[model samples]
Target: MSHRIVSKFGYYSLAGFAGSALVQLAVIWPQTWIAVVALGAIALLYFAFLLICIKGVLKGARWAGVLNFNVLGVDAIESTGIVLFFVVGGVWTCLQIL
Candidate 1:
């Protein structure tokens, strides 16, 4: 689990967000100018976590581990919300048919 907890998923999460921020900006061009700040903030958070882990400047290695898990925790929360929405929507449609 250390591979996932410490290295694999956390690093990928940061990189993925950074990539998405760029894509998000491109997709939201013109009228939605403010999305740059919003998505940039999310992307920066991931990069900051990556920097702290790589730099070894934190008080302890444990804090990096904690932050890594926190990243996963956030991912799970967002995924759960989306999943719950779909589940609720599906049930609502089913109920209407019944």
Candidate 2:
């Protein structure tokens, strides 16, 4: 409903999407045509949802607030997965550099 809420949602959604993508890529270790295609499809759908949320937020739709809240809840559940992914990936990257 409010612009502040919309902006917060947009920021969180973008962050969540990035985190999810990273985790997906790490888990799948894409190495084949099917894997690439599937990842691409998943990316497309993810972006679509993000776009819808953005549009709804910009338009100040009440439904957007509801959707944003739901997304936040989902993100919270995925937070653990994202955190683990980040921790492992960060350590791996650091070790490689060292």
Question: Which candidate number would show the highest TM-score if scored against the true structure?
Answer: 2
lDDT of 2 at 24: 57
Off by over 4 Å in 1: 1-29, 57-62, 65-98
Report, for every candidate in turn, its global Cα lDDT versus the true structure: 0.49, 0.55
Full-model lDDT, candidate 2: 0.55
TM-scores, one per candidate: 0.31, 0.39
Task: Quickly count the clashes in candidate 2.
Answer: 0
Question: What C-alpha lDDT, on a 0 to 100 scale, does residue 83 get in candidate 1?
Answer: 36
The digit string of per-residue lDDT tens for model 2 on 50-88 reads 667768878889889776344446564464334444344
lDDT of 1 at 25: 46
Candidate 2 C-alpha RMSD relative to the actual structure = 10.8
